[model samples]
Target: MHFDLVDLRLFIQIAESPSMTQGARKAFMSPAAASARIKNLEESLASRLLYRDSRGVELTPAGQLFLQHARVIMRQVDYMKNEFTEYGAEASGHIRIFANTTAATEFLPEILAGFLAQRPGVTVDLQERLSRDIVRGVMDGSTDIGIIAGPIKADGLQVIHFSTDQLIVITPLEHPLAQRKKIKLTETLSYPHIGLHEGTTLLRFLNEQVALSGQTLNMRIQVYSFEAMCRMVEAGVGLAIIPESSARRHQQTMGLKIIELDEPWRVRERSILVRDLEALPAVIRALISIFLTHDSARERRS
Candidate 1:
């Protein structure tokens, strides 16, 4: 049977709220108008779609079955609009992305600059959050894409290897370890170490490495943001083992000395995550291509 989009929309709204009055408010129609529309829909389908009671309204079996099909139809309708809306240079859209502090502060600026240069009409909304939050945002559809450090196990998300980064031990310029090219992981335990919170990906990696070696890291301070960690290290509060990208960014400002870790736990892979690659918008796909290609070139150089 043929149904207008408006009828389907009203049906979904009624199914969602159940109360005709509440559904009318949501659909921005008067109660009488909304009721008339719903009655017309039921008449057209020749089915009892809702059962009214003293408390509110409930969907009949026919309504429940119709709601499922209505949802799919609405989704397809939305997809069609989005597909055509972002079609060309004149067609504009917004992309929302989530990233951890290191990637947000270090990596995304250049990429965004290039993207905006190419697509001036498009807008990007970036949220800087912890790795776990970034992953959650991607899974929940709150963000279009996420850039994070490894060891996340999220089902249905496509994880692409974008870049590999090393962790560096940083101290104030005049600190004892400054003179050393590389310091043993064991040596760090002797000194106060400023670290990210236990929940962060970096801290999780560090803890795993320490546990694997049958040792534990001695954390002097636990902070949420990398900028805070760098500031603390520069103030001589303690040395910190932070992502190399973060250390590179703050090296000049903090006058921090960065030394490589001696053994196995130094390197890490950074990844880009998307809920579904095939479902991503063209703008996001373009950004992903740029990120992967740029990182590949950098890898070839190294």
Candidate 2:
């Protein structure tokens, strides 16, 4: 029962992408060919791999099991290629990262710039995902490292402190609650709000708060960037719950009010999650070491 690594790679792509067809397209193959390759793989293994529906493809239990092995095989192949090219290439390998919207938007750019500057030969492939999904990607071996906002249950994961962030309400200076120093999130629910695009980590967290308090949020506008959301709030469109770090940056420029949230969950702590610290690739370890050093320096300065 032999299968092509290309097919395995295609299957991994399909498992990660929105659909089987998109995965095929990514592999530079047609949809029919992708399906046939997956079918052959399943037939060879004598197990169903994916569950397809209107939404998209999801890994079945068997598929999840298969992914673990496939990732190991792929990593081994990558390692061999890099080893062979070590003399020709100074330092080069791909690092896959899964980070939530907060880490992706807030502090990653600065940290990543520093990392890449020092390791010019390394390339990074980063994808933004919800915190929980980020954990899943790390646990499933889809990504080498994951930066998640706030605390989450990532069973079988090695967790370490990455950073601290928080969600705060941003309002026009003249808004009703602008005078208040701090307020419960539920108190602001009645007012029309400006929210980030759906599916973002901050937006999802806010929605969960709304759901828990049994209050509906009047989200007037959904914008892409934190700065855009602040601009909308400044225009008297509505208020928004945004990261304090971002909001603080726009405070003077946008003339917006940053109101601390009364809820304990408002202050978020970011953590790095990995499957096995010892097993991390050398490049990944180097990257993590730099981040840790930076965080320590900030701590000392603060």
Candidate 3:
């Protein structure tokens, strides 16, 4: 009825390896000891967890179920250890943030630099995720905060206005589309496009929109960064959809024309979402405060 972490860890290792000997070696235990520990674990559970043969070992159905729970337990243990390890230091805690494409790429770098500079003890784990996924991560306690763009329904979470990010198309100055002031996404799909590389949050979102429009994007080239994509577009390669901030900055130097997107969804209001604002640690609250202060300053100027 009672099982220890060591027994569970060893069982997981054994299940992953081709043989108990290899698993024992990885676990830093002798094969005999490993075998005995596993035997005791199976006896306690009253189930045959593995099948042994001359070649290797295979997990039984019960073992498969046990392995899933064991992995989850170990992961939570590690996460807990990491979360509290710095609490003994001065004003420190780990914060996990999930942000969408625009927030992660265009907004957070400068803000995070200042935040981290002031508090050396605090650490942030920031990850880029789709907005819907970021919302789920915040609600499920996987992420402490979420920054998302567009109007995604967050029924119960606390929401704060972060910034406004608008998507616009950029084309070479002499291109046919450059003559126009505005256009729809569907209209641009017929033309060759320069896009961000696969797996970017922005590209994924755009692809989803393309699918919903019942059309496919004709991507001529895919690059890693907005700067690169702009360069490609300026070379008459293809048109590109980029953030308005980036398009404005690049337009000053690059020979590109900014064309407004006529669709209503093109202008996205980015927001910060959190499960609870009052319950957050001081460090996270400070970070959120910085976000709001900067956003407010920008709004006032605009």
Candidate 4:
């Protein structure tokens, strides 16, 4: 029937206080204005809502029924206001994020833990995929944010350089190459390698490096996951190139030896991807800030 929110608010105040003067005071309006609002609301509903006599104003049968609906609408409006208010402060709502396997398993855990500690009301749903898939997810509206190793070419996504990760060459502790201080590209290819599948960014980067050094990587196994690569290296199956963070994450249990790749292929930048900078919700922005500032500080300390 198109009753105004102002009239609904006045009706609620009058219903609660049962006194038009008190309702007017609570609403910061004159008694005449409050009565007129109540009158308009009753007219909109085509019913007589209140009857005033010796004992404060009393609701008619229709007024009592409509009051129930009015209370529900008021509560819903209040909840909406609170939700938006908390959203602005990064204190509420859900965030959908996509990350590569390395970031999902190795890096994002601690960062997400810290973010949740600060903003418990905000929930994050993270999905792990290949770096290329992560970029596609961000572009296709499947995810609110993404983290991946760069050379990202997605035109629709906004990329931010968040942190740098070094790829380390790993081998079984007993492997003869484990003792090396720095492994050259040529030396690396001399050993059979356990590597990621063909389409992954890591594999692409390694292939580029191998081509640049005028050698072909003697890839022995093509696995889909880094954890699998680590297990294979631990079993002395073959050596693999993986991020230093992933190496450290499994260091103790895997008992694998890790060596820094020599000059040419040392570090890779981990970039944050967003669909639109302006469209990012406050909680996601706060999380990005947390990752940037906290990871930078942790990197400096190390």
Global Cα RMSD, each model: 6.6, 4.1, 5.3, 16.4
Expressed as tens digits, the lDDT of each residue in 124-239 for candidate 3 is: 89998887889887765667899988888988899988778799999999888889988999989989999987877789878989999989999999987788988999999999
By TM-score, how accurate is candidate 1? 0.65
lDDT (10s digit) by residue, model 1, range 55-75? 778999998777766765664
List TM-score per model, in order: 0.65, 0.81, 0.72, 0.60
Candidate 3 TM-score over all chains jointly: 0.72
Candidate 3 colliding pairs = none
Tens digits of per-residue lDDT, candidate 4, 177-201, equal 9899888767877889999887666
List runs of model 3 lying over 4 Å from the truth.
1-91
Model 1, C-alpha of 83: deviation from truth (Å): 3.2
Better of 1 and 4 by TM-score: 1
Rank by TM-score (best first): 2, 3, 1, 4
Tell me the spans in candidate 2 whose CA falls farther than 4 Å from its real position: 1-60, 87-90, 300-302
TM-score winner between candidates 1 and 3: 3
Better of 1 and 4 by lDDT: 4
Alpha-carbon local distance difference test for all models: 0.79, 0.84, 0.84, 0.80
lDDT of 2: 0.84
